[model samples]
Target: MQILLISCTQTIAVLYRHVLEDSYCLFCSISKQRFTCLMSRKTAEVTL
Candidate 1:
C-alpha cells in the first residue's frame, strides 16, 4: 500500500512537471537548472 502510494505521487509529479514546463515555456524562458530546482522544491513540499 505504501509503495503504491509513493509511486502514484511520483507519477503525479511527473505529469505536473510536464504541464508546468509547457506553461512556463509559453510565458518565459527559464533555464533547465532553474526548472529542476523548482521541481525539486515542489516535490519537497509535496513530501512534507
Candidate 2:
C-alpha cells in the first residue's frame, strides 16, 4: 500500500526531472548556436 504509493511518486518525479533536463538541453543548444553565429559575424566584420 504505502510502498506502492511511494513508487508511484518516485516514477512521476523521475519523469518530470527528465522533461526539465531535456528542455534545458534544448535551450542551451539554441543559445550556443546563436552565440557562435554572432561571434562569426563579428569576426568577419573585423577582418573586412
- Candidate maximizing TM-score: 1
lDDT of 2 by residue, 1-48 (tens): 111111223333334443333221111111221211122122111110
Clashes of each: 0, 0
Candidate 2 residue runs with Cα over 4 Å from true position? 1-8, 18-48
RMSD of each candidate relative to the true structure: 12.5, 19.9
Model 1 weakest lDDT span, ten residues long: 22-31
RMSD of 1: 12.5
Question: How far out, in Å, is residue 11 in model 2?
Answer: 0.1
- The TM-scores of all predictions, comma-separated, are 0.21, 0.20
Question: What tens-digit string does per-residue lDDT give for candidate 1 at 1-48?
Answer: 112121223444455564444222212112332222133223321221
Q: What C-alpha lDDT does candidate 2 achieve relative to the native structure? A: 0.23
Best by lDDT: 1
